[model samples]
Target: MEKSNANPSIECTVTECEYHCQDQQYCSLDSIRVGTHEQNPTQKSCTDCESFELKKSY
Candidate 1:
């Protein structure tokens, strides 16, 4: 498959995630959905990556 040149990049330190490309801190997915755990999120911790998938194998 041809890699999309326009893939939006976001720094990801969660190496345990499946979308995290090996050796790189960038997310491999084309898009991600960010959602807050609470209705009134005031901190970055409140945000969650709904698109995050636990890596079955690393």
Candidate 2:
């Protein structure tokens, strides 16, 4: 498997989106998956994320 950047800023969301924030900040977790909203129909909407105004987590 390809190694991902350990930097928290690189990941803007959580692995399971139930904890997603308005600013895009997420809690620390083992791993995360990314895809286009179209690909993952259940993906959280980050258009107006509050995390943008708050803080970012890895």
Candidate 3:
């Protein structure tokens, strides 16, 4: 999947975190897994992400 050059126009509260989507659909940040936050299943907020890493395009 390629990184999206198309701006999602969405701003995430996780300021220090970098995020990229796979095929421009799903966030591909390997630093944290999606299902890890079982307590807050509906919580998509990345503000609490401690291991967030940015994805670079080649």
Highest lDDT, which number? 1
Residue 43 in candidate 2, Cα distance off native in Å: 16
What lDDT tens digits, residue by residue, belong to model 2 across residues 24-44?
454333444444435436535
Q: Which stretches of candidate 3 lie over 4 Å from their true place?
A: 1-6, 20-33, 39-51, 54-58
Which rank order by lDDT, best down to worst? 1, 3, 2
Cα-based lDDT for every prediction: 0.74, 0.40, 0.43
Clash count for candidate 1 is 0
- Candidate 3 clashing pairs? none
Alpha-carbon shift of residue 25 in model 2 (angstroms): 5.5
| Best-to-worst ranking by TM-score | 1, 3, 2
Q: Give candidate 3's TM-score.
A: 0.24
Worst 10 residues of 3 by lDDT: 9-18
Error of 1 at 16 (Å): 0.8
**Candidate topping TM-score:** 1
lDDT of 1: 0.74
lDDT of 1 at 2: 22
